[model samples]
Target: MTTTRPVLYLFGSAAPPVFDVAAVVADAQGRGFEVCLGLTSTAARWLEPRKAGLERLTGHPVRSAYKMPGEPDVWPKADVIAVAPATFNTVNAWALGITREFVVGVVAEGIGKGIPMVAMPCVNAAYAQHRQFERSIADLRGMGVRVLYGDGGFVPNLPGRGKPEEYPWHLLLGAVEEIRGAQGEGRSS
Candidate 1:
């Protein structure tokens, strides 16, 4: 029997790349993931104008709120969760286990469920230097979450100076692919 593509929960925070997330979504699907989108309320607005296109791409509703009572959840169970273009606020809130928004809620629950996750930050260099951001990265990494940053991952861009091409959208997908490969190998071994 043919297996279904693995579901990947693609979360986006309010950042520049969130405006052009379709490219990232296209990349993830190319690497064999079945993508589902969840955005921070703020980020959701950025995509709202093109919501129909995004929905068609993912075959799922882009969720940003709690589902109505007794409404069946439409999102698929994730084999992995990737948060791309994560902002400083989202990083800190997630590390502190705050679930005030749908994106953060998925993160908290994903960690609890032992689902592999990867995050790619899009903070400015100044914001990246914040004590909270540093601590959040450490705390998340300590929990086995792949916080993709630094040399091989996302490097903070200079304030108001970086181009959209500089965001390491692929690193987030690569991290997820690596984790999935590792998990598959584990099962076979």
Candidate 2:
């Protein structure tokens, strides 16, 4: 009904899987859905998306909220909002309705507008197990935010290596499927 494709809000630490991002985008676009992208501050550093490149890919302005003035938020017209490689900080902020930047603002807006939001928390076991972090995740779930977690999404036994290919394809695809199912696209051809 008034859904404008799907907007994916990507965030991470110093490094994230650009390949995963590309793969997800490719899959979604191939499925005949438009995609919009929002990058977190640190993510911008590793995967530098040219202004025009991002604009052309997402058909929406791509930016890191900190670098831009005012808050960048997802339009209410969006059908789905997904945070892939969701940082612990970002996840907690979203659950608390805190808006320190564009991505956070978009998450808060999604909550306020009752928009369906999905997140793939990409953090290590230690950080993820932290009491505050766990609580924040619980809070988000209570509010109807779908969270995709576990080792399938978290790579183990890898130290000091940051590669997009290291990220689990199955888990990422599963998250994508979750969003599709939520958007009523699961039954679509």
lDDT digits (tens) for residues 76-111 of candidate 1: 688889998888999999999988988998898888
Best by lDDT: 1
lDDT of 2 by residue, 140-182 (tens): 8898877776544554224344455666645655666677676
Q: Kindly give the stretch of ten consecutive residues in candidate 2 with the minimal lDDT sum.
A: 6-15
Count of residue pairs whose backbone atoms collide, per candidate: 0, 0
RMSD of each: 1.9, 4.2
Candidate 1 weakest ten by summed lDDT: 1-10
